[model samples]
Target: MLPNYLCYVNSVLVYRSGGTNRLTGLMLAAGTLALLLVGPSVIQYLPVMVVAALIFVLGIDLAKEALWDTIGRVSREEYITIVIIVFVMTGWDFVVGILAGIVFACLFFVLQASRGRNTIRAIFDGSIARSTVRRHITQRRFLEQVGTQTQILKLQGFLFFGTINSVEDLIRRALDIAAWQRNPIRFMIVDFSLVSGLDFSAAEAFTRLQRLLEAKDVVLVFCGLQPDSAVGIALRSVDLWADNGVRLEVFANLNEALEWSENEYLRGMYASGWASARAFGRAMTGAGESGIEAARTFSGASGSDMGAHKPSTGSGAIPGLEAAGLDIPDSKGRQPAFVLDSGFENSPRRSHLQQAVRMALERTGGDAMMVGALNSVPEIEPENASSSASDAEAGLEGSERERTERRTASSGEQLPPNALPQPGDGQHQSHNQTAIQQRKRKLVQPAPLLTLTFKAYAQEDLGQEFFANLAPYFTKVRISKGQKLWERGDESDGLYLIEKGILKARYDFPQEEFEINEAMLAGTIAGELSFLSGQVRNTAVHAELDCVLWKLDGTNLDRMQMERPARDFSTFFRMLLRVTEEEQECLMSYLVTRLS
Candidate 1:
């Protein structure tokens, strides 16, 4: 019968369990089988130890997720429970740790119940307050609550001096902040209110607080100190240190205590510096204030000597900007700073960091930031506002100074989207920035240096399907400034059909007329030698404005050669090369006719 039941359970587990749990269950079952076959000695040292080690690793993971403060102050009773279990299960009988920990936890709860006390809540002023006053506990009850409003702490079992630490820290913080504190209480409504209790140490601690508050003119109010109890009325008689200041009040009715608390609260608020601004009487009595003095009094600091405006580009060096921030613009010291505003803390940093991440993800095609699983942290922009404007003449790219002055009053002009340049050492930085701008110009026309017009004719008659098949074999590549696509005198094996961007192909020579002759843009083709023969490259290819062009290799031609229309275009290669020439001429025309 038991064997049948076991089989049924095994079928359920096998169907429902997944990888991790199945592995764990298999380990446990194998360990149990080993114990049965090999006896406890050998099995305990091997499989049991391995399983226990894995379980311990799981515990470590749980501990990492727990809050630091809670872990720091684990109760002494809980510590003893863990320590005792560990001691019992260190060697031979290892499973005893888990069993002992569970048993001790249950025992701790039992201990709490054996020493518990209950205090009743008293109602007054349409709200229930924490206090002690007259109540019915079999023919005798005094005021259920008393004194100005405060916290109620109910004690059970023996009172020790250690409890003092808890009371003092709780009270001080409560005075400044309107939150329920867990330590030194300002005004405590210790509900010995129903504590038919007495301990010299606990009684003395309460006395000390009352006196300490008196010396500092701080108040300590107590509730439910019964007149007839052994330690009750006597505690009311003893002086706290010396000043017989506001004597702790004992009440007979809950309502009376509530009425008294409301009056006291109002008086305390009036004593503080804040009164309603519209209170005419206080204003007439010279209690009102205005202007800088009033602002200073509220903030509580004097003579800071800070004049108004923020430091500017003219104010010399301010730190904390890096490529980590925006690239500071190439017009540095020549342009106004890019000021970013944000709706979050460290506004400038929040905006810069957010923009930096967006630029990185876009620049790298998302693969750079997204690995197999976790998203990588993008580069962080530096946190401070940086100003790097150079001298007045630096703005000579035009009268940029005049434009800046005209826009000075307007806080709205922001850094262009093109401002987040790719970052690295000086080497790739310029190239990456230029490449991005060049591609953007092709797509959105943000800027354009050249344009090309093209018309294609078949070198031989062919069909449309042939040309369509060959079209896909072409791919575009973008290169930034100083990127050596090919070196001079080296073999250029593959073909480049320029679709956009400035690729200036020049033979290295010094001349008075022009340093470069061919400025390739849309519909230009180059690099046919090494690409066909698979030989060494020739002619260095440097991107003028981050160029993009198509790569048409031998495989591309081979695939399209069978297509009728593609086969018809015997001079198709030369037409693509013509496009490169037109682009280069356009750039040269711009340089000589306009700028020159």
Candidate 2:
């Protein structure tokens, strides 16, 4: 025992100390010496079971503490991870099991991230208040049509191969629906704001979608993308589907992406002359802008350029066909006959005749003057006769001026100085009496401004008289079926009163379908959403049939405020407010009924 103590101190603790261990060694040596000298019968009295029982109880306490009660609170994937570690450690090698658990958790995490959620939240118009870009009225109408044709897919969660299928399916379905509705899509916007990460596989899906859309002549746009986001990095790493003649645009937000898409669509239409869209672009798309630039670029180099001058030639000479350029020697020419022979019997060929006629018209002076059947040039005989005719024309002109002056003075209620007659003349007395009677009639009864359906929507104090007075300020518009009157997100510039025909109010949803909100019949007031709330339009109104509507915009309101008396204008304004409230109530009730 004393030797064992010395070995333990030297090999284990490794410190030069001779305190309790040395004393214990001395005691054990003495005890062993005494036992050898006296007796060894007392060694069998120790209780080994009690010590084993105590060890077992301590192990039970540690096991109970290790089995945490909150295991169920974790995710199933985490539970699987825990189970793997525990099972392997209990049944196999501890280090190997730990390594296996780490690998399993990493794999599971990757799988979970790849299966993230992606969805669409909303779809709206580019004309919305925040997306204000200048456009012509026709261009705006086209944009409204584009709003119906554009599909916006607002995505949520991570983007990977597993989620890309669902996203692509949504787009495909939307496309199919558009085609079925006879309104094929022109643009598709994918908003990836909720995406947390991205990989090459998902980027490939976007490329595939772009190819499919391009085949249908549709442009694809990516929006709500973070610059350094995982998806952004993956997309950038792959050169972002920029190859293979397929083009796409990426934007930081939805509104910007929509604006860019609209601009691109407008330019494409202008360049291609599709649907004769160049007329709208020419007026709305300003000089040096996208629409005009596209037109100029595609219109070809033969067109006139800013500083390029046309080749000059003598009045009767054809430009670029001068004698020197034609290389015909003057010595051999008898001033060539200029006869254009067409191989036609009796009459020249159509094109040849047109060319000969054009050349004759281009000749200077009266050498080749051609006149139509209805137009004749009368010949003047001699100089004296022409002078006599000129004198007669001067006399007629003087009489016409005198009549015009008389009419002007009569309208102004002031007799011209030269037209004044002597006092008490019978003719003068009669003229004065007639003028006074006419002025009296005009002052007593003014003509009506404009005729409208004055019988509709009138209430207390707001009757035929009210509408008659208001009718002059409103403008009338007629829209055909399937034509959009105004779109959601259009400026709150006016209110409308449907005079005839039916109108449908619709809203675009995230699901890429329009929900018909209500049917607006004659007498129904539209645009109350803007008129009352002072916000942009939240719904679009389209003509269900040929509709006649009376429009009242701010210009009309300004005119009312200016031309009408203050008391009358204020009263009319208040009545309009009341009408707006009633219209809103009607709309709300319609919605409630439809929803219920």
Clashes of each: 43, 0
Task: Show where candidate 1 strays beyond 4 Å.
Answer: 1-158, 162-164, 175-188, 233-246, 252-255, 266-596
- Residue 411 deviation, candidate 1, in Å? 49
Candidate 2's residue-wise lDDT over 1-596, tens digit each? 11112333333222223334667667668878998987767666757786456545544443443345436677778777877776676677778777989999988877765554424344443322113222222333444444545666667666666667777776777668445355445667777766677668888888778778876656687776765877777777767644544567667765456555554443333333222222232222222222122223223222122112122222322221221111112212212112222332232222322332233222211111110100111222365544534443343334335565778777887665656543345655565455433322211101011111211122333332444466667776879978998888988888776644567777667767425345554434577558646798888878766776668788888898899889777776665565565455534432342232
Pairs in clash, predicted candidate 2: none
- Positional deviation of residue 424's Cα in model 2 after best superposition, in angstroms: 29
Where is model 2 poorest over a 10-residue stretch in terms of lDDT? Answer: 366-375
- Quick one: best TM-score, which candidate? 2
| RMSD (Å) per prediction | 33.7, 23.2
**lDDT comparing candidate 1 with the true structure:** 0.38
Candidate 2 residue spans exceeding 4 A from truth: 1-72, 118-146, 156-158, 175-184, 192-197, 224-233, 241-244, 263-563, 566-568, 571-596
Worst 10 residues of 1 by lDDT: 368-377
